[model samples]
Target: MGQVDPHRPPWVFDCKLTARTTPNPEKFDEALRQHVGRPGHWIDLEVRGDCSDAELELIRRLAQEADTRPVVVRHVAKLISAGQEEAGHDEPS
Candidate 1:
C-alpha cells in the first residue's frame, strides 16, 4: 500500500469496484452516499483484478454528479501491475 502524505487531507470517499461481469446498482447508490457534502473526498475504486467498462462509466457519472474531477481510466491497468510487482509477484515475460 502506498503511504499517504501526512500533509494531504485524509480521504473521505471509498467505493469498492464491482466485478467485471456484474454491476450492483445498490453499491453505486451507497458510494454516492459518501459524496454528500464531501466534494474534495477522493474516491477509491477497489477493483478485483480488472475494472469493466460499465464500472468505469458508473464511476465517471458519480464523479461528475459529485462535482469531482474525472480520473483517467487508462492508468488503472498500469497501477494494478505496479501494485502486483510491489507485492513481490513476478511478471510473466
Candidate 2:
C-alpha cells in the first residue's frame, strides 16, 4: 500500500464482473420461494489504486465464461486533491 497523504483525497473505482454457472439450488433457493432459473453470479470488484492491464485481463478472462456478460466500469470521484496544486496546474486543460 502506498503512503496515505493526509492532506489529499483518495480516488476510487468500482467494477462489476459477472459469470454464468449452474446455480446452487440450496444456496439460491429459500424455503419459502424456489429459485428455478437463476444461473449466474455477479462479482463486485473495487480498486483503490491504479488498475493495470494485466489485472484487467485476468478479470476479463474470468468474466468470459459461458452465458456471461461484459464487465462494467464505473468511475466514482471522492474528492479533489487539496495539496497537489503544482501538479494540477502543469496539466493542460
Highest TM-score against the true fold, candidate: 1
lDDT of 1 at 30: 53
Q: TM-scores for all candidates?
A: 0.31, 0.26
Report the number of clashing residue pairs per model.
0, 0
lDDT score for residue 66 of model 2 = 23
Could you say which candidate leads in lDDT? 1
Candidate 1 local lDDT, 1-93, one digit each (tens): 678866553553324433343235466545455533345445544333346788777666765665555433331432332123233357689
Q: lDDT per model, in order?
A: 0.48, 0.39
RMSD of each predicted structure: 11.2, 12.9
Residue 87, candidate 2: alpha-carbon lDDT = 22
